[model samples]
Target: MEFRHLGRSGLLVSEISYGNWITHGSQVEEDAALACVRAALDVGITTFDTADVYAGTKAEAVLGRALKGERRAGLEIFTKVYWPTGPGRNDRGLSRKHILESIDGSLSRLGTDYVDLYQAHRFDHSTPLEETMVAFADVVRAGKAHYIGVSEWTADQLREGHALATELRIPFVSSQPQYSMLWRVIEDEVVPTSEELGISQIVWSPIAQGVLTGKYLPGQPPPDGSRATDENGGRFMQRLMSDEVLSRVQQLKPLAEQAGLTMAQLAVAWVLQNTNVASAIVGATRPEQVLDNAKASGVKLDADLLKAIDEILEPVAERDPARTYETSPKERP
Candidate 1:
């Protein structure tokens, strides 16, 4: 797989990194999860992204077991905080107590002493930004994590956070956001601001949660066992399952053929086209799916095709810049 520097940092991550969000420890059984992880490593993927809130934190344990024998120095493992991992009040948010304590639990679950990157899963509205950043600084200083990043944070929030990281001498090197052909909310503002601050995006849902793969037909019931059919995961995907969006996505199949890529590869490559995107995080249920996605690594799409894609999907896509902040919880969940 092709590798690119994650933001302005010297660290390089796979162009298409393996992420276990809905699959590991929930949708897929442990054996299937292990097979997918092996498929990723077989295709040269060295970066893995998970979260403490994913599958109630069981995703990390499964991932740890999957990568048990690999050399730790050769992999870049990432996990996040700020979501409720337990029933207690201290079990969530970016407060000093939570951040400090959460990192230890994450490390233990991930079977590693330190994570390559530790991210705030979301902006903590109740906690002071200084408290959060200072906690992150402590995480880096104590060698619990090598870098700090945040997910789904607004442009203004990124600017403020970056400033705090600079003041604290922490490496705030990456932004994790939901980005895809169907989601352009980050392009108008976050991309420019992150560029100025030297932060690159490690985008999730590059395929628009599989909508871009053309598997969901317009006005039709979602296929059996699809993400849209899963009660828990389906909710997040309902917004994009509309007939208008599905019809528009279906229009891209010919473009994929024109580019000699499968619909999924086309979708994955489309995100990496952006210079500010360091990696596109992909999750899968089977080894074949992982293999197909890894092929998108170095494929380059011409400007004409990209323009055609925009013309087809932009009208149906979510581009309102404020939608970024709107997606973040009004208060911590």
Candidate 2:
């Protein structure tokens, strides 16, 4: 597997990392999840990304147990905070209490004393940025986490947080955003800001929620057991499941053939072409899927193929950075 440094930090992660967002606890059985993890390891994937809010906080436990016997020093395990993990008033957000309390719970669930990286799942508009950064600093000082990151954050929010992270002298090294051939929201602002601040993007949904896989054929029912058909796991994918999007995706199969890549590999490789992207996070329910995605690591697409992809997908691609997230005052746990 090819590896790259996480931002300007001294840590290197596999270019194609494994992520269990909707698969570990909600979409697959424990044995299946464990099998996928093993497949990732067998194929040389050393990075795994999960979030505290994924599968109602059960994904972390499954991933923790799956990697129970692996050498911890050889893996880069990452998880995020700032989401409601419990029904309490102080169980969420980037507040000092929440970050402090949440880290202990995460560590306990993951069976690890520290995570390689702990990210803020979202910008907590309700919490003071100072309180949040100080809490992160404490976590690093206490050896609970090695570095900090943010997910789906606007460029402005990232700049604000980076300023505080620098002031506190914390290692803010990564940004996790949903980036793909069809999702260019991060390219305009987030990428530029991250380039300026020494942060690398660990992008999720590099296949645009499987649309780029060319499995959801146009004018047909989504394949059974596909992400677009799963009730709980498919909610966020509805936006990309439109007929227009599916039709556009179908047109990419010939390009994949010409490039000697599967549609999924093309999609993942497309994201990695950006120098600022440290890794592309791929989720899988089957072991073979992991194997397919891992091959995208070192595959380089020529300039003509890339231009063809843009021409075919640009009309339907979502590029408005503002659509990435909506931030405002709200109660966060």
Model 1 misplaced stretches (Cα beyond 4 Å): none
TM-score top scorer: 1
Q: lDDT per residue, candidate 1, 1-333, as tens digits?
A: 999998889999999999999999999999999999999999999999999999999999999999999999999999999999999988999899999999999999999999999999999999999999999999999999999999999999999999999999999999999999999899999999999999999999999888989999997899999999997789999889999999999999999998899999999999999999999999999999999999999998999999999999988998999998887887767
How well does candidate 1 score on lDDT at residue 281? Answer: 98
> Could you tell me every candidate's TM-score relative to the true structure?
0.99, 0.98
How many clashes (backbone atoms < 3 Å, residues ≥3 apart in a chain or on different chains) does model 2 have? Answer: 3
At residue 312, give the lDDT of candidate 1: 96
Segments of candidate 2 deviating more than 4 angstroms: 327-333
lDDT of each: 0.95, 0.93
Model 2: colliding residue pairs: 91-333, 92-333, 93-333
Q: In candidate 1, where is summed lDDT lowest over 10 consecutive residues?
A: 324-333
